[model samples]
Structures are given as structure tokens and as C-alpha cells.
Target: MRLKFQFGSFITFIGFILSSLIVTLDLEAQTHQFKLIDEETNRPIPDANFFYGNEQGISSESGDITINFQPTITLTISHLQYGKRSFTAEELDQALKKHQLALQPKSHNLQPVTFISIHPNAGEQEQMTLQVQDKLAHDAGQVLEQFSSISSIRKSGAYGFDPVLRGFKYDQINLVIDGSQCATAACPNRMDPASSQVPLNMIVEAEVMKGPYSLRYGNAFGGTINFKSADPSFTDKANLNGRMGTSFETNGEISRSEALLGITSKHADIKLFGSLSTGNDYTDGDGVKIPANFYRSNIGGKIGLKLNSTQTMSLQVSNNYGKDVDFPALPMDLRKDDTWLINLGHKAVFYRGALSSWSTTMYATKVDHLMDNADKELNPRMVDANTSAKTNNAGGRTELRFDFDDDWLYAGTDMRIENADGTRKRNMLMGPMAGKTLTDNVWQDARIRKNGLFAEYHSQGDNFHLVFSGRLELNHAEAQNPDAGFAANYTDMSSDIVSPALSIGGTRTVTDNFSIGLWLGSAQRSGSLAERYINYFPIGLDPYEMIGNPELKPETNNQADLIFNYKSDATDLNLNLFSSFLNNHISSEIRKDLSPKMATAPGVRQFVNVDKAKIMGFEASWKQIINRKIQQVAELAYTHGQNTTSDEALPEIPPMEFRYRLIGSFINKKLRTELNFRHAFEQNRIAKSYGETKTPAFNVLDIKASYLIVQNLNVAASLQNIFDEAYYEHLSRSVRNAESRPIYSPGRSFYFSLSYRF
Candidate 1:
């Protein structure tokens, strides 16, 4: 609740006249460090790890490190004794003018592409880099709604949202891309999620794996996300590159653009990309508006090959589209959506031994959805509903990784095939069913086929590091046509599930800088496709008309976690605590012998099997550098869900949140600035029989800057919410006649961007 200071001084004077119309005149360059050498004993090597897009930094034992240039600053170094590479910045700016830079010590240590196990192996790994240099993120749930612990599910006005970890969400989390889990959400109130169909400038990284540790990648009960994009490399001559960017904002005049291209040779590689975005309807620091409109687009391509030198292969394709999207708290309005994706992959490595690497991936997805209420507003028993949906998925995975002496083993096999069918139509257009016409079949051909087998084992020492994981699955669901009110209220819709999963975690060093970690897990999830063939369909959440419970029964998450850490040189910290204990907990119940077909529905609900439930959480993170021109980051999160056999509470839980950021690096780092703040605190443990609503606290502020208009171009600006905060975010959504109104955010905006790379 902060606004009107002349609307934050007219959005800080329109972000200072759009940063003086795209600023100019300021060219400084000071920040240093870019040294790492050891090409055959050239010395200085220590700790290594570098990256640009996903922004990582390390290298200090004398090997320097510090990067923030851009011109497509591609980095990606990594080194244990030299084992990864990718350079650019004009091949390291002449070794940063002799500031070192040299590496090449891989007689054959092969294995890259994270065939599996590389991230905390499964116990608490969080890597997010979806553009967050102080505000301006369009999708991927606005970059996990700003990291730490995470929560999102704002049912659109800005784009699908979704993502909710800790308390889990939809299919209990598992969003893969690049190892493709083929985009899955074709509206059923999910308005097309799959992290909003990629395209956040084609994401270059996103990783999270918090609870159910890992089981290769299947039945993840509540954690797993891996989104990576853009992988191109080559040398030995022959190259061509490209990139382009665009952005603009001022409360709903949103627009974005993207482009990229690549070509390499020495074996082969190719890439292409495209993007587009648009928005409108925004004005809410008490100035109303808020219908939230959208249009999106994306295109893609990829190719690679290098058949010798330890095998490799790749292929990719993509398509994403959306139009006129909007969901005023859900009731149809998304007029179109189309998604298509494909993936293929292969790799082999030998390093030396009985088995070292093997990987394979294949995928496919398709979605076509349409929704309508003819854009809301109009009613008097005047029917006009419409909905058309589609979803299809295909999957694959193959793995084998092994090494001994220090330990590592992994094996896998995966499969999936899903299909959901839909249709709905109505058209009364006037009184007493005037000129009636109705139809149904909201998913009458549901199907699910799965098969899995996984394994993992790892070990390390010098302090500790361990892992072990497992998975076993065989699910088969079928509705295969059943829509006559779902075969007269249920006749055993056929299911055959067998799930199992396990995980173990480790990390311990309790000294030389503190460290400790632990994890335990169990997972299972079944019952989807609308909990087993939705038929009455109102998609639950109070207006109630849902039904679908083909003998439901599979929901388990017996998790645990604990962690603590601390680092040096600038600062880095962590603290986590988590819990999950649920069993056969799939909610919804109430079917007073069914009787409520939409006249503003009020009875009828199905999909049961609720025995016990629980969820608990905590998170804290910090990063600091307070010296060379300030820097800091902070985070805190919370969760608490429950349903202890109906003692209630738990339906879109999300309340405690905190964030902070502050950065500045002027005249030497080529100018950079940031300040971010966020808070959320009021939310009365909702779920009042699921019409949940109690939000009230919020605070936001943002400011940004960027320069660098040379070394390949850059420009940025921001003012987002600088005191204009009408807020509402506690798992948003309300207003069916306004139940304490929610879903409001976006005011005092001004953002700008420009990018280029060679």
C-alpha cells in the first residue's frame, strides 16, 4: 500500500525520461581479474569455474576471476585440472592483456553435458539465472518469482506462472527442458505452463532439486527442474555468430524481442532462434485497469554432430505461441495457445575404463488450447462457454555412467506417453436456453503410460559428499472414452500404478568454514489427467462441479532435509530445513449425491483419498561482497501446509517471503546499479474449504541501471514499483464477485533494454 506521490512522481519521471532516451556518454572500465593459467605448467590455476549467461564466478587461489562484460560474453570454463572450455570475449581479450588465461589439460577426461550427477548430486542445488539484474523478467514464473525457496501460480494476466516448490504443485514438480519433459499443461486452469513454454530469451539455465533428491527423472513428488538452452561451440576455424535483443515497458506497453543465430564447424553445430512478446492492460497501484492481455511467440532450431572423438549428436525444434491471454481469476479467456517441441540427443564418452558415459534423450510435445467466455462480461443465464484443449507428450531417456576409485554410478531407462482429450461447447445466447446447443467431452480420452527404472550412487571425501537414489515405476491410466457424466458416475476407470522412489543425501565438513547437509526421501504421485478423467468439470476450487476419482490412490512424499553452510572471501551462506510427510493425500471431497450443473455451482466434488498430509519449510540464503563497489543479496522463504485428515489448511499455500538485493558498480564495471526489495507477510493460513483468500501484506521496490553500450552493446533501465504497490500475491486469484479481491500488481512501471552480441 504505497502509491500516489503523484504516482511515484510519475514513475520517477518516466524513469528519468527513459534514461535520457537511451543514455550515452560514460565509458569506464576498471574492475579486474581474468587470470587462470596452466597450459602445461604455466602455473596459477586454483579453483576455476566461470560462466557468463548463468553467471557463476570462482577462480581465486591466485587465479583471479571477475566478469561482467557482455557482447555475448560466453564463458563456461570449469576446471579441476582443466576439463571444460568455451571462450569468447574475443577469445579472452588477448588473455585479458596478459592477465593470464590458458588451460588445456585434458588428455581424455571426457564427460560433460551432465549425463547426471554434477550438481550437489541431488541434495540442495539451486541455480537460477533467468535475468534478474534488478527486475524485468517475463516468465519462468518471473524467474522463480525471484529465487529462494520459490512459489508462483498466479494464474495468468502476465503468463502462466505455476511453479511452487516446497509445498509442491501440479504433477508435484518436474520441469525438464533440453532433456525435454515435453511441455505439459494445456489449460485446465494451468493456462499453458512448462515454464510458460521456454522463451525467456531462450533461458540459459535454471536448476533446482530440493527434496525428493533425484530418481533420474520420474515421479518426482516435489522437486526437479532443469532448464538449459543454447549450447553451441566450435573452433579450428569456421564460425559465424549472432544475437539481438529488445525490450520496452511502461505499464503495459510491454514489448520484447529476441534473435540469435550460430554456425560452427570442425565437426558441426548450428542454431537459430526467435521470440516476440506483447502485453497491455496494467495499472494497479490503485489506479485500477488490470485485465492483463498478452501475445507471445517463439521459434527454434538446433543441430550438432561430431561422430568421432567420443560420439555426439543432437537435434531440436521448437514452437510456442499464445494470443489474447488473460485470466481474471480463471473463467476462460485464453483464446489460443499452440506449442510444439521436439528434442533428440546422444553422447558417449570413454575417458578410460569399463564404462564412463552414455546418454540419450528424446522428446516430443504438442498442445493446442482455446478458451472463451467471449471475453467475460455478459450473463443472465446467457450461455456462451467454449473450451477446446489438447495435450500430448512423448518421452525418453537412456543412461549409464560409472567410474570407480572415487565412486559414481548411475543407470537409467525412462518412458512416458500421455494424452488428454478435451472439448466443451455451449451456446444459449439468451433466455430459456434460447436456440440451445450444448456439448461435452472435457477429456474423455485420457491416457497415461509410463515406465521407469533408475539408480544412482556417488561418494566423495576430504570431508564428505554422498548420494544414492532410486526409482521404479510402471503406471498406466486409461479413461479411453468415458463421458456420459463419466460413465454414469464412475465405473472403475482403469488404473495400474506401481511407484517407488528413494533418495539419500550428504555433505558434511563442519569446520573450516562450516558445512552440513542431509536429506532423506520417498516419492510417489499418481492420479492426474484431472485426477482420473475429469467429467463434471468446473476444475475445482469452490464453484465446485468437479468429479473424477477412478479409485484414486497414490500420493506420497516422505521427505526431509537440513542444511547449513558458510563460505569466505566475500560471503555466502545458507540455512535450510524442510519436511514433507504425506500419504494418499489427493484432496477434494463432497458429492452430496451430485446435483449442481453450473448455475453458479455450489455442490458436487469428487477425487478423494485424503489420509494425512503435511509440509513444512524454511530457507535462508545470502551472498555479499560489500567491498569493491557494494553487492549483496538475501532471501528467506516459508511454507506450512497441512490437511491432517481434514483438520484443514492447504490449498495454494504461500505467504512468508522476503528478498533483498543491492548492487552497484559504477564507472569501471561500466556502470551497473540495482536495488530490489520485496516482502510478503499477511496470509492467514488459508484453504477455507478451498475458496482460500487472506492476503494483505506486501512491499516492493525496484530500481535498476546498466550501461556498457560498446563491447557489443547493452543498455537497461528500470523503476518497477518504486513505491507504487497495490500488491496481492499469496498465491493470487480472487474476484468472482470479489472475495476480498486479489490479483493486482503492476503499477509505476518503466523498463527498457537493448542488447547485441557478436
Candidate 2:
């Protein structure tokens, strides 16, 4: 009986071992699949080198190369200039099965040989410029304050982001966030739909296209700023991530807490980002308390799917709410402002041969806003004034690129439809005394439709390169208002513009450490709605009001720019110079003594088409890797603008500025610190309508430090306005009161953040 039991135990042990081996073999047989792509354009990459253990693989010629391997094999993907990327066997298997892997292209060698490469977000290619990541800010209003070009940032009582870009306010420049355009209607007070609704922390990056090179964005006469958010990452594996932070200021106001939560998996990725911030009224540098206390709350979510190797679909929804936000410069304060956003998009790429590579995207957006005046009793002019506004936009874009041997060519088409509607009502106390006890209610409705087509060709060789490109656009606009008390009937304003763009540039390597490049280019832009049909009250100008012209024609501009770049292993420098000439330039001018009813006033401002204008500027930037532990960077920008029609300085031109930065890293890459300083030459040549006084120049300082507390944890702290400067920025608006109260920026402030990943 003992012998029989022993035999049975031995047989059972052998069977169990065999079963375990079979399961291991089956798991190893499961293959992992993945696709690599360009981060900027979402295009697949080809001819990339991939390695696993001792095995090597290369991408296919069509940029759609695939790799298959066991779940336990460690993998690495790399290219000459791009940094190397490594993934564990399990991670690769998960990503391949789910299809959510993307790689950033190497930038050092990616510069086009024959074409003046322009990124979709970065307007026209003028010179090398630094792009800022939006995640550095806690809110939209705070994000704009980080840029040098922006002088003042404010939140309307209605909870919108109102920014003064290079001294130009309200409608002078075009703002685009995730392919959506914002519209202003109601009250002419611009109380709602402020840039603040889009939280800065949600933005991935912001590209500022300086000058008129951004004609494609809209009728932007000044420039275009495109705020892009981070794309969702989808991988075969399931992962979760979250972030939390807090901030404080010296003005006795404690900010509320904020946090973010997100998750990604092979089948789908979902992200929920939100923040709740509240603070009491802040005091200025001199201990003078400003009554503009504010609180804000925002939430954003995105759902993304990996449809297949060549396709992706995504849906995004976001909302922002603000309350009791005050503006010292405005006559009235904002009581409540709300913004809602919804976006859906699809991206795909098709390849047929050496000559067929194309990409397409379509999207739509809607914006709604409402605003009411606070302190109405103190400001009788706004006692009974309120405004409500809505804007809708839809657009589609397609591009086809072909490559042949050493030559390449591309063509693209884009179309967009935009509609804006709003209403403003005045209370009985604010009724016009001279006019019929004005129950003034103004309604404005307008439509803008545009279509554009463009093409470019390039040929590159070892010693030389050449490129040519052109674009033609057709625009149609119509505005109707039943209430004549505010706007006139500008039935239809249409034009077909063929704005040809050309660029020629070449590079020659003179030595092992130096190279020379020369470039020249030109572009054109049309007028925007604000310059066309704006007829509203002027808050900045004491006694004058602004009226739009219905008969205004399209403005045209011609520009040329040159750039020089030099680089070595440790140091790099870039210099640029550009000039632009505009014809039929649209500007607001005051007609002296034109209105008999207001004869005692200075004059009335009206939008008019000027005969000519010119702008010239230069930018220089240098970066030095100094040593293994330290790096330094410096930049300078100067712009000079003039109205040739009147032979005077332009009203809202940016001022000369200088920036310096130093970064230090210690304990390998574990601890880092940065110091930044900026100086601006005050803009003295202010437009009459802008203000009655000139702004003084000032200097500002900022500091940041970060430490990796552990493998997956990081802590950071930052200080802005380190010196507690009391001067107002040139971009700040002036109140209409006799005291001319200028909006003062926050004195000194501090913020701390913590992030963890698992």
C-alpha cells in the first residue's frame, strides 16, 4: 500500500510541472505590435531604428513600420538626432495591442532644406523662437502673465480671460484655442467669454505668431496666438496618473486647493482635470487694498480611442465658472461668468506610393457667455447694463504631400464657418437723457465664411535647396442688426484674395563648428470684424466713442524677413530682421468737432481705412550650455511701427524688451533651479484713445526650483514679481475716472506644486 501511494504522488507532480510549462509557452507566443509617429503633425515615421535585445528592426519606407515581439523582450527605439526611447517587454506588448504609442521627432536635423518650415501653431516662420508650455500656469489668466508680450491680465466680472497683448486690447488680435474662435457681443463692455475660461494648466503649449504672418487665422491685423492642449496618450497597457498643488500670495489672500486625475489603457483613455481656486481682495505694493477679489473653478475632460493603426477618434468637454471677479480699471465689476466647450475630431493618414501621403481633420466648437455689472449704484452709467453673447464655429482641413527621390511637394485646402450673436440691455437709470429715455437694446448677428487653398514644392540636394509656395483665399462676411440704435446694416462684405507666399532659403556648412543660412519671405492679411462693423462705446477715451465703417475694404500688407543661425556643441545663436509695408491699413481715428451734439468733447473715434503703414523689427537669442551643470540663455526683441498715412508712431506697437535666464542642475538630474529676469522700455507713444498718460518702463524678476523627491514624485516652487514692483504695465487699461486709476498687477507671490505617477 505504501509503494502504490508514492507512485501516484510522483505522477501527479510531473503532470503539474507539464501544465505550468504549457502556460508559459502560450504567453510567450502572444505578439506585441506598435506604430511610431511624429508628435507635432501626428504623422507616422519611417526608417527608424528599433532594437530588442540583440535583434534589430527598421521602419518601412511609408512611415508605417511595425514591430512584433514577445511580451517579455525589452525594446528601444531611436533615430540619429532624436533622443532614444526604451520600453519594457510588457509595456511594448500592451502598447502594440492597443495602438497608442507615439514618439517625438528629433528637432536638430528636422529643419527643412528647401522650405521655410512653419508649424501649424507657430504662425509664419520669421525666426527661431522659444515655445512656452501651458501646463506651467494654474489658470488661463495666470498663463498669459508669464509671457513678455502680455503686459496685463484680468478676469472680467463675467469670468472671461481679458489680456492686453503688446498693448493692444479687445479684438485687435485673434485668439484661437483648440481650433475654436471666441466672439464678443452684448453691452459692448466685453464682459464675457474672456480668455480665462481655458485653464493654463490644461494647455500643452502656446505658439505666438508675431506680425501679420497669421493671415490664415483670420483678419488679425496684429498677430495670432494658438493655444494647443496636450494630446491624449493611448497604450496597450492600463495606467493611471494624478496631480495636486496649492498656492499663496503675500497680500493676505489664501488660494484654494486644486487637483487633476487621469487614466489610460489599451482600449481607451479618459482624463478628468479640474481646479478650485479662491482668494480675497489683494493689496498693492504700497499696502493699498484693491477691491478686485476673485474666485474661479474649472473642469475639463477628454475621451480618446485608438480606432486602428491609421485612425483615431476623440471627444472633449470642458467648463469654467467664475464669480465676484473685479477689475479696477473697468467702470463695473463682473458678478458671474461661465464658459462651456465641446470638441470632436478624427485624424487619418493614407499612403499609396512614393507620391501619396495625406492627412485630414475636422472639428466644431460653441461658446456662450453672460455678464452683469457689480457696484452698479456707484457707477450709474452701468447701473442697468447687462450683456449676453454666443459664438459657433465649424471647420475642416486637408493636406496631401508627395515625395519623389530628392524632391517633394504638398497641397492643402481649408474651410471654416463662423457665426456670432449677442444682445445688450440698458436699465432705466442708465437711459440716454438726450435721446428718447433710451430703452437701449442692441442686437448684433454676423456670419463669416472662408475657404483657402495652397500648394508648395521643394527640391533638396547635398549642397543646395529651393522651395516655392502660393495660397488663394475667398472670404464672405455679413452683419445684420434689427436695433439701429447700435449697429448699421452691413449686408454683405465679400472679397477674393490671392495672397501669394514665397520663401527662398539655403544653407552652407563653412566649417565643422559653423554654418550659414539666408532666407527671404513675404505674406499678406485682411481686415477683421472689429475693424469693419464695430460701433460701440469707448471706455478708455473720456468723451469720444468709436464707430465702424461698413464700406471698409480689405487691407493688404507685404513683408520680408531674413534669419541667421549658428551652432556648436555648447553654444547656439539666432538673429532675425524683418520689415512690413501695409496699404489701405485700417485704423481708428478721431474727427474733431464732427458731432455738434458733443461739440464740448474732444472728438469721436471712428474706424477708417488708412493709405499706408510700416513696421520693422529685430530679434536676437543666444543659448550656451556653459558646462555639465549649468546653462544660460538671453534674448532681445525690438519692434518699431509707424503710420505712414499720418507719419506718426503706431498706437499699440510692442516695446523693446530683454530677457535673461540661468538654469542649474545638481545631483545628476535630480535637483534643478532656474532664474529669470526681464526688462521693458516703457511705451511712451500711446494712442490717444488708449490713454491720456504715458507708461513708465520697469524690470521684473522670477525664480523657480524643482526637486525629484523620489522615483515617481516631484515637488516644485516658484516666485513671481520677486521685487514687489509697484508700477503698472504698459498693457494695463486706465479707468475713466478723473483719478485715472490704473490696474495694478499682483505684488509678490509664491506657488508650490506636487505631481506623482505610477
Candidate 3:
């Protein structure tokens, strides 16, 4: 991969933005001492800036501020960790005279832990912040299902539930680890999304942006998922700490073991983490066994150097291995998989001059995937077939931040290069092709290069806050296939495309407990390698093969969002409405005129660019305290999508769904319990041209509880599918082993976990 850089042009652009920072000051000064802290954690907010008119000062390491302010001045405070807030000078003076001021924490939206369980004795407490160890103990090794807005598209009854957001899937969503882009799935069927590469025990925090609001992340059309790893905790003197945990589930006979160790010092810290998980075929409702089994192991470590209090540098590396991974819904099962990832980063904060902070990071990842059909039963004794795919990705970003009196600017540039290639081989065992082997390159030598420059601006005033952002993007892709013959001419192609994205949004506070906000954005997505180069690739759960169209145009999306939020001591509510109009949407179309080779083949579809499409939806979530001892949380989501040009519903779209939880706490907050209910409406809309299938509605209930046996040790138990109902999700794949029946979710099962830290 090659990239062209214009440093001179970028320097001139930065100079122009800097020119706006040199204005004259207007102030009536009176010295005052103040402190800023987070309302939720009561922790000091370092480097928070306080502004009065044109006078500005930043907080010290301990969040202490000594600033001169006018009696009539309106104090505006801002921080990257926290959004923005404004207060009257008199209010601040009163709080300062009394002590520290606690700023109501802004919406973290950083994929914080959302509790879904109910402890019989616990009341009204729906969510609890969990450490790495606690999360591992609570979750059944399912990493991506932690977010409320995200749901998984299960391939089987076992591991690897591909995450789906809103109505978008696959490349539409971007997944980043430690601020670096990750490699795409080596399997055309996407058995291995980026999230599956890291075990839950390795994640320190997960952040999700719902839409294309932040331009810093690459091509964030659907959204961006940032997985932050645990950094070494530092102390005055060097210290060694460690933790170990294990869990088991009765339904699938699943078990997981994890361990973590760390060494921390004032200036340096290092840590290592590892996990091993295994599960057997699970039984669905009616006691029918489901052929879903998998085994996975992962190990990772990070080393950090403080480099003083204002600057830091870190390096991280990880590897994951999988074996006996079976996908009953897909054409092939994973025989083995190996993945490796490495990243290095440097950051500097509290710097002098207009550059309040600057950071740079670099990362690379590689994946080797192999799958075959040796375990499946074939009607006619047939040959053996296997696929070997590999993908590599490397990218880095450098960003600069500037803070002013009432506004801030964030600008950065990032680039990601990806290379993928694979081969499929079929050996004839009993047919005419028996004793002979035929091999074809599925991906060829395909490559994709994406380079982008982005900037975001945020400003605060009396009663409203505004955020504006934009990105300039350029993309290129090419593939080489020699043995494809006519297919080569059809799939061998090159593309160089350029596009721009813009978004502007604002929030107006109706009152202290309620707010209304709106945003409109335009984003573009270039065709992926598999969308442009793959030949006869089975991307779905069925035997349908997909052909790439190299001459495809980039898809464009124009969307609008409206949000209403209300928060109080006893209740919290959020409602969101969104609509998107897409241009040149790419989807599979059955084409019968495929040269002579596949003209009569059933389910052979080719990717085609459609003229128009629309996706609109709404999501509502409510949490209310029924009493001091019990709480309730409910969420509802619905999405409708169609090919406006064809007047048909889109294929593989999820159905309307709702989830509710009843929670309770007891034993002085040491024991908690939750009762959960989930419902999905039947999906009748089908894309007949694309061989779509309809699914029936489902309802399920679950119960869970957790308790602290003693300090540093915890125990949890859960009963899922309490009624043992037979139900399948709308997005579940048609199972091959079950005569094309949709794979049903796991049946009644009991799970228990325990952890102790030392």
C-alpha cells in the first residue's frame, strides 16, 4: 500500500485555524479558588478548563483552579472526559466558598456496563460498574453483547455472534482497538469479526458512537466501536497484583478460565491477561441437541511508561487461537484460526501554547483462517472442500486538540491499509472429479487503502451546545486474479474514489431534567474487497454464492436524527428517531445470464448497485425506580428498510423487538437479582428476489442473581430460557444440519461463576 502526503498543505490549514485563537481579552478580574470533580465518581477532573468571558485557566493535576473572575461573569467549564457545562458566577462563588463543585457528569456513552440481571434481594439498582474481573465473572465469554443498542447475529448456538447495530452490518460499522483500525474478517462469511479477536478479560472500556458524529474515526457511517485495553495502574512504589476467575454453564457444558497479572510502579506498569473458553453442542427447546460447539484461547499484554505526569507511551500485543469452531448455519466450519495484533502509542497532555494536547498511535493485525466440510453429512458421497483466507491491516493516527475560552477544536488524520487473499480447493473423492483437485483463488491478491483527514468543533453558550464535524476521505482498491479466466475479467478491477462527509448537531436544554437534540449527517462507504473482487463466495447462511461487481459506485447516506432525553433521581428516559436515504446502495441480485458456467445454478447472486433505498427507525429506553427496593428497565427498537427503487423490503433486516428487566438488591447492596423478558415481532416482509425467509415472533424469560460471598470474592448464578421455549431470532441463519430450519436459541440452562482477587 502507498499513500501520498501533502504536509505543506496541511500546515497551511492548521495555521488558518490557529489564527482564530489570537483575539483580545475582555475581563473584570477577582481571584477565586475552585475545584472541579465528576459528580458520579467524585474523582478530580484533571486539565479541566474554566472560562470567564475571554479569560481562561486550566485546572491543576488535582483539579484545583485559581482564576480571576468578574462578579457578573458566567463560568463555562469544559473537558474532553466530560462535555460542557456553564454556571453563574454567584453559584460558582458559593460552591467554591463552601468547597468543591461537582459537575453533573455528561453522558459517558462509552459503552459502560449495563446490568441485565436481577438479584432477588436487590432493589432499583439496574446497573453497576464492573472491573475486568467482575465482567468476566458475569458474562459467559460473550464480549460484544454487552451493549444495549447492539445485538448479535448468531451463526450457531455457540460462540461468535456477529454484532449488528441499528440496521447496519459488516463493513458499514467500524471496529477499532486501542485507537487503531483492525483487520477485516478473513472468512467471506465473516465468522471472525474484529471483536472476537480479544477476550472480554482484556477490555478495560468499550465506547460506541451511535452515528457519524465523530469524524476522527474512519468512515463512521453506521457507528464506531472503540475497545480500550486495560492500562497498568500505577502507584508510588512498585507493586504486583493478580486475579483469576472461572465460570461454567450447564446448557452447553461450557467452561471458561481466565487469569491476569500486573506490575505497577510510579513511572512504569506492565500487565498480562489470558483466557480459555470451551463449549459443547447445546440443546434447544424440546431437548433437541444443537450442533454448536467451539473452543478459543487468547493471551495479551501491555507495557506502559509514564514519561512524566503529562506524557505517556505504551505498547500492546495479543494473540488468539480457535479450534473445532462449528457454524451449523454456514457452508463451512472453522477447522482452525490464528490471529495476532500489536499497537504502540504516545500521548502528551497539559502542553504549552495553542496545542492543549496531542497524541499519535500505530497498530497492525494479521489473521489466518481455515475452514472445511469434513464433518458434515453429504447426500451423495462427494469430494472434500476447504478454504484458507488471510487478512492483514495496519494504520495509525495523529491528532491535535485546542481549547479556547468557549470552544474547542479537534483535528486529525488517519490511514488504514488492508490486504486479503484466499484459496478454495475441492478434491474429488468419488465423482468424475475424484482423485483430482481443483483450486480457485477466492480473494486473489486484494487490497484496500483508506486515507482520511477530519476535524470536529464544539462550542457552548448560555442554553445550547453545538457540535460540527467533517471528514475528507480517499479510497483505493485493486485485485489480481490470473486463473479466473472470464471471471478474472469480471472480478479483476481497480477503484480510486474520493468522498466527503459533513455533520452538524446541537442540543438545547429544555430544563435541568430534559433536553432535545437533532443531528443531520452525510456519509459515504466505498465498496469492500469482497464486494468488488470475490467470485462464487458464499457470504450468507445458505448455499447462495455471491459474485462481485468491480464497476460499482460508492454508496452514499444522508440521515437525520432526533433525540429526547429526560433524567431525574427516580427515572431516566431516552427516545431516538432516525431516518436515512441511501444512494447507490449495493445488494445481492439474482442474475440468470451469468456466462454459461453458472447460468442455471440456483441461488447464484451478483452484487449490484441500486439507485435508492431508505432505512428509518426509532429506539426508546426507560428506567424507573418502582420503589427503594425494586427497579424496572424497558427498551423498544424497530427498524424498517426497503429498496425504494424496487419497492421491496431489504434482505436480512431485523424485526421489531423489546426487552424489559426487573431488578432488586438486598443484603446491603452485596446481593442483586433481576428478572428479564425479551420479545421480537414476526418478520413477514421478505425480499423474494433475494431468496429471503420470514421468521416467527418469540418471547423468552430469564432470571439471574449475584452475591458477594466475602470481600474480594463473588458468586453469580443465572437461569436462561426459564420456560424452555423454542424460539429463533429474525436474524438467525437457516441451519444446514436441520434441513434449512432457522437455528433456534439455546434452551433452559443454568450458569454459575466465581472469582477471587488477590
How high is each candidate's TM-score?
0.31, 0.77, 0.86
Per-residue alpha-carbon lDDT of candidate 3 for residues 257-302, written as tens digits (9 for 90 to 100) = 8887888898898989888888898888977788878888888988
Candidate 3 ranges with C-alpha deviation above 4 Å: 1-38, 41-134, 137-143, 146-148, 481-483, 486-492, 595-603
Judging by lDDT against the true structure, name the best candidate.
Answer: 3
| lDDT at position 686, candidate 2 | 54
Task: Note the Cα lDDT for every prediction shown.
Answer: 0.71, 0.55, 0.72
Tell how far residue 297 is off in model 3, in angstroms: 0.5
Which stretches of candidate 2 lie above 4 Å from their native place? 1-174, 178-199, 211-224, 252-258, 354-358, 376-383, 405-410, 430-443, 456-469, 485-522, 539-543, 592-603, 688-692
Model 2 agreement with the true structure over 231-302: per-residue lDDT tens digits:
556655788865555555445464655556778887677888777766666655666566656767778888
Better of 1 and 2 by lDDT: 1
Candidate 2, residue 371: lDDT: 52
Q: How accurate locally is residue 209 in candidate 2, as Cα lDDT from 0 to 100?
A: 52
**Ranking under TM-score, best-scoring first?**
3, 2, 1
lDDT of 1 by residue, 308-373 (tens): 544567787878888888888776789899888887776654434445556667677888988987
